[model samples]
Target: MFDADWPHRLHSAEQVRALDAQIIAAGTPGFALMQRAAAACWRALRKQFGEVGALTVLAGSGNNAGDGYLIALLAQQAGWQVQLYWLSEPAGLRGDAQLAVQAAQAAGVAMQAFDQQAEANGVLVDALLGTGLSGEVRAPYRAAIEWLNQQTNPCLAVDIPSGLCADSGAVLGAAVQADITVTFIGLKLGLFTGAGPEYVGTLVFADLQAGETAQTAPSVAQVLTSDTVPRLPPRSAACHKGQLGHVLIVGGDLGMGGAVLLAAEAALRLGAGMVSVATRAEHVAPLLARLPEVMVKAMRSAADLQPLLARASVVVLGPGLGQSAWGISLASAVAASDVAQVWDADALNLLAAGTLRAPQAPWLITPHPGEAARLLAISSAAVQAGRPQALARLCGRYPATVLLKGVGSLLAEQGSAVSCCVHGHPAMAGPGLGDVLSGAVAALWAQGLSALEALQLAVWLHARAGEQLGAQGRGLAASDLIAVMRRLLEEHAPCRT
Candidate 1:
């Protein structure tokens, strides 16, 4: 479950700026909004670190710096020792920022020019850069960010961590690694994806009471949470296994039998009526030994897969399908079938290599950054630098719903807003996880959810399961998530009414 009040809509930096202007235009004074933002930041800092009795505020020339100046005034008024360092000249500030600096000065908060030798005392506050950053960080600001990061003291970021791209989450040269980040108005899309997760320590959102103005603002994406994810409806008492659809998992080359087995087990556990595995002959014995309910078939060639494909409602392709002739032939056969499909692992690699054409039926492709890079013809670094862009490109290239899997997994279809899953943990970083996800997606689709709906539900379920199991720390096996996911799925969507 997730916090319902936590905003699900994610916006670009530009959209947030527009929302701010709308709020000010709707009669909230710009100065008043700035004060609210400062107060929110002050409260978050105190809550996160307790009353440190001393504050270090780093200010630049933007409105973000204005928040910092007002925060220094708050600390000063509360009888705390405060040090204010300005990365930019105070004389260059205008409008609300100018008013903020004057207020701080009048309040007797000491201001000093920032220098390389400046030491951070108490809780270091990062206010040097904000959402306007489009290029790599430069000169004095970059120096300030580096210095802030080097400090061992507790640090709070104002609005966003300086030098981190608010649009793409790309670290602009160097970004401040804060212990807490207090953001305002709308949640920026960057704070949840790409390098954003690594740089944004603990995120606190304060709307500054933008209220109706924020609700009407257009958003570029939606974050997946308990309130937003799709749920399966309860089945009737008359329902039978035949009423639920069949899922065919096709993969598991020579030594990679475990990948297909994982997928088949996940599909079976997630409520698919019938789960079939068409992997290598060597895998059949082990697959049945583990999951006898699955109709395990030993495939000698692509021809052997046609009968299974004909009978299946959905096919999950490419868990451990190797690139060898045996694997490629099977992939080609699956591509020709009209069944709904979930493409993953070596199947995606084969698709990227042009060994098989993109499927004509309703399908979903789950690719991590490396596999996505292959599909997009770009370096994996390029994909990570702009994950949303890559996701869009993948959607544009394929007719199927595209799921770019990684931290903050993104899912999208043609002409739909991107959905982001921010629930997974680092302990999920292991093999066979993607295979399990592929099976989950196929299972949901087989149960009659539209491709996009199935993808949305499956990604959330998988991530939430990983997050729950990840609490035990490292050594999280991929198989460990299957039972947890099954339990969570039933909790969200009961089997009987």
Candidate 2:
């Protein structure tokens, strides 16, 4: 029951089957596994509710149902009133679940089949669908889920809240929103992101005796936590500003100087050696007025920005760059440059329009779901439906890495796998966060990380910073986060050996 490995243990349905086979091959009985699952559920239920004597267990016709029945047996043994409402006919339950039903009967745990007059007076345990669900929830299950939602009592969901896509976390139809979720085996990706956090409530994990060998199976990425992020490369007393690398931020069309200004300021605060901005001549004065340390260059066209681009170790593009001819032309030039890049905002839109190509050098694109939808030529609804697949698609179409921003920002590369940034607060929903992320990512790239590593680290740091800022309260403006970003970089930056 190592907390960190729980996620890997509660895997996709296919992975769960493989691990189950592996355990059975090791001579553990399938029924034993069922018993273990039931025990785990019973423990979680008691821990969350603190020894309430009465219970209502919602049972379906699958392994999940078996777990529910076993829970009833445990409650009866503990001298509590328990009601098992079988949403499906109890006789329809087969395999270990059937055995569980028989055990519950032998234990004298009261059970009934879908009584419309039933009312949940105590805690409800949802043991309906597990990770095997696909598409929309059908029939009595949907009705039952809705009815469960109407109850005033707290709920405890088994494995995942039924109706959540195990991989993507999207609700298939009506999904149970539980007060506490106890997941077994592996921690399905859906449990941490999308609608998962809201429906899952307080998450608890149980392995049911699945071991580390089960952890080695296939996975796109795991959720990112504080312990997962690595320290930045160390700096020495002998090191000078020149060693840190220069980042050139290009964008900020007329009257939009704030965009590139934010990017440049963020890059500097994150410890880039030198931060420069290449934008419309009118922007140069205003940028310098705000961020005096930044070197602002006036660019009449793409050619004027070429030498600066060549000098920059990394480029932050598309911040505040509107979709007019000037922005499109400059974006084309930046796309063609060999400089490593952090692409955002209008730059991403330009790329989607086919006016720009994926850069040959290392690059990271930061896009919210809407931007991702445009890049993939799909609706935002579709992109949100399958975040992992959408992220994979973006990484595949563009050779560079991508940071798909949302509740759980995903970082992935075409050749490598995806990793999620599971930190950050809801306060991060305010404006200019993406620009901050772009700058931070570019700073990391300039500091000498591979594209994938840079994107992963950048997203993690950005989210962590917001988490720290939002610890006090909500309403976090993007500017309110700058100091935290600097402190995080300084504290975690590698200490010279």
Q: Quick one: best TM-score, which candidate?
A: 1
Clashes of 2: 8
Model 2, 276-302: lDDT tens digits are 998999988888899999999998888
Residue pairs whose backbone atoms clash in candidate 2? 7-187, 9-185, 9-186, 10-185, 10-186, 10-187, 11-186, 234-494
After superposing candidate 1 on the true structure, give the runs of residues whose Cα lies further than 4 Å from its correct spot.
Answer: none
Candidate 2 TM-score over all chains jointly: 0.95
Residue 165 lDDT (model 1): 85
**What are the clashing pairs of model 1?**
none
Q: Candidates' lDDT values, in order?
A: 0.91, 0.82
User: How many residue pairs of model 1 clash at the backbone?
Assistant: 0
Task: Give the distance in Å from residue 340's predicted Cα in candidate 2 to where it truly belongs.
Answer: 1.1
Name the lDDT value of residue 348 in candidate 2. 91
Candidate 2 regions with alpha-carbon error over 4 angstroms: 1-10, 495-497
